[model samples]
Target: MTGSDPKADLHRYLQVARAAMLWKLDGLSEYDSRRPLTPTGTNLLGLVKHLASVELGYFGETFGRPSDEPLPWFEDDAEPDADLWATAAESREQIIDLYHRAWAHSDATVEALALDAPGRVPHWPAPRNEVTLHQILVHMIAETHRHAGHADIVRELIDGAAGLRKDNDNMAPGDQERWRNHRDRLERVAQEAGRSAAVLPS
Candidate 1:
């Protein structure tokens, strides 16, 4: 246990989350990749674009190594939630390439700094703004994984595809018929539970 490198472990998890996010875009058409699947417009390529901005800010700007590339959506004059969705001009390949570049920059930051290396989050309030590489790593790992979960759902909604990764979906092995039956069972249980709740005394 003692011999295990904490940084390496954390980095590995981050990388996995990153890979999962990108994998969600696989086999998707341009329209599907940019499709606003949710009411608030959460899309696959948008997720990638958002993560790229997150990594650039947390790993680059927060540590005084701001990215050489410009992120227009982050500007003060840009429309709200601009980073959350891609425009028509922003090609899928362009956003994906940006994400790859962000990974390289973030990896470099992880490599160059020690776990205890101090940094400041400009947008964070009060003393919370002060943080270390370890804290940022943990924060980013959680952030990436959270968005990856969103991607999983969005991708499933787009098609029937669902899983943590390509090689291993991390889902129960079952045919479509079995899945439909399972869903029907859950719906029945939910309706029964709702009826039971409604019948209870206030």
Candidate 2:
């Protein structure tokens, strides 16, 4: 490999970000990680479960090498948000282990396939025909990060531990007061938008 191979560079950045996302859950108690953070039951452990399925599908099935393991849910018919919470019989450790394993297998595909390597996303509405490893990678990055956010909030609520990474390397750069003000501003904006939407003419 060259001293700074562009291919390796991109992959490394993606891998780093992916690891940071998972690391956000480190050291948390099982109950806390699996606790329903919202009324719809979006829990950290459940996100991990959903991610495992996504990675397996995008990387494995896309290549005509779908996994043989029994999917955690939606095997036949899926509830609207069945993938957003843990099943009564599923332990936190099992879900987490499966997610990590999915990462290993999915990343191996990333290494084996080229950015333009063709994949078929049978579920897409229009392009229901084809895709590529690059597009899938980007989609996965977004999905993982979205769920990692769920993990972040849940973790913080559990033990006041909040960060996008285990080492807090990706956290804010300023004082706590400034951060609070920023968050408050965001909250106010959201509230205002909600109120405005509610009051709009029918």
Candidate 3:
């Protein structure tokens, strides 16, 4: 394991995050996948759409290998946060397909470039915008996992499903009744702590 190639390691982690992102949509209905679960309209499919755009921008445009795909939502006159969601016209399958294509394109960029290969982020501030393939890979891994975390919560809210991945849930061992009891205990603890603080010296 210690002899593993650095680039391969980074790419593997990026792929893991990508898989987790898509796995979140498994068995979800179109409505459940698209429905806004958060105050800011975060949804499972929206997360997929947003990450696809992120990968394209970071890996494609930054590397001077731009994608031919038309992304009107990113145009100057487009609505705010247009990339953060899909329209009714954009079917779930379509968005997921786009995401898969984006992954292929990004992977090509990764394969063609060395870790230190230079690229520039046109949208980032000057000087700071200059970056290497290594930097982009690290940045993207964090970005994808961050959104995957959001999907985890959103998916759980829509149904009772929750986990790090389909293979390993990474949750405490418990039945629903046990889980409910655990939550109740935490609530009681919180309430007790709140009262204790309220009675503390001013």
Candidate 4:
């Protein structure tokens, strides 16, 4: 396939990562979407909330295009990790809509600046606070995809549903029995290794 323009290419990949992350929340009850699947309280909707705030800061305020939206979670007196989880009143619809709006605002910042356009990250430490549009684009891409990976695992834990996306599962074709057998084999190998390590000389 032919290549897209640089900005278009970056934006396309960012959208892919965003969609992949949001797709993990599809077809789940509100409780399931907000349920903390991991010990650290990582949940599908929480991830959406986190990314929305991340984009708003990196693309909006960092670049001098502050969003009209207020993020109480980032306020001075807010609790630690406030943006990392959704509150009871924060519905899945609200978080998702915020994320989509972040996309639009972030897109505007991208459109208004060149790749080499300079900006300062006020939250960052000295000597590394300044950045360009290209840097932020790459940074957000990595951040978005990292969360998408988390969402992939969380989604699987929720209902055993696993895939890169709806149309393309991106997993090897295997029956449930075959997959179970494979997992059992891996578990046995891991246990053996653990046992062997335990018996090693100090």
lDDT of each: 0.95, 0.75, 0.93, 0.93
Off by over 4 Å in 3: none
lDDT per residue for candidate 1 within 47-161, as digits (tens), equals: 9999999899999989999999799999999999899888999999999999999999999999999999999999999799999999999999999999999999999999988
Instruction: Report the candidate with higher TM-score, 3 versus 4.
Output: 3
For candidate 2, write residues 1-202 as lDDT tens digits.
Answer: 6487545666675666567656756776677767887877777777777888778888898877676657747565776767667776888778877877887888788888888899898777766558878788777777777766777777777776666665555676777688789989999999999999999999
Off-target runs (Cα >4 Å) in candidate 2 are 1-7, 172-202
lDDT of 4 at 90: 88
Ranked by TM-score from best down, the candidates are: 3, 1, 4, 2
Cα-based lDDT at residue 159, candidate 1: 91
Better of 2 and 4 by lDDT: 4
Put the candidates in lDDT order, highest first.
1, 3, 4, 2
lDDT (Cα, 0-100) at 165 in candidate 3: 87
Clashes of 2: 0
TM-score of each: 0.97, 0.77, 0.98, 0.95
User: What are the per-residue Cα lDDT tens digits for candidate 3 across 1-202?
Assistant: 3587999999999998999999999999899999999899999998999999989999999989999878888999999999998899899999999999999999999999999999999999999999999999999999999999999999989988999988998998989999899989999999999999999999
State the weakest 10-residue window (summed lDDT) of model 4. 2-11
| Top-lDDT candidate index | 1
Instruction: Supply candidate 2's per-residue lDDT for 24.
Output: 59
lDDT of 4 by residue, 1-202 (tens): 9866998889889999999988999899899998998889999998999999999999988889999988999999999999988888989999999999999999999999999898889899977989999999999999999999999999988998888988899999998898899999999999999999999999
Cα lDDT for residue 71, candidate 4:
96
Q: How many Å off is the CA of 48 in candidate 3?
A: 0.5
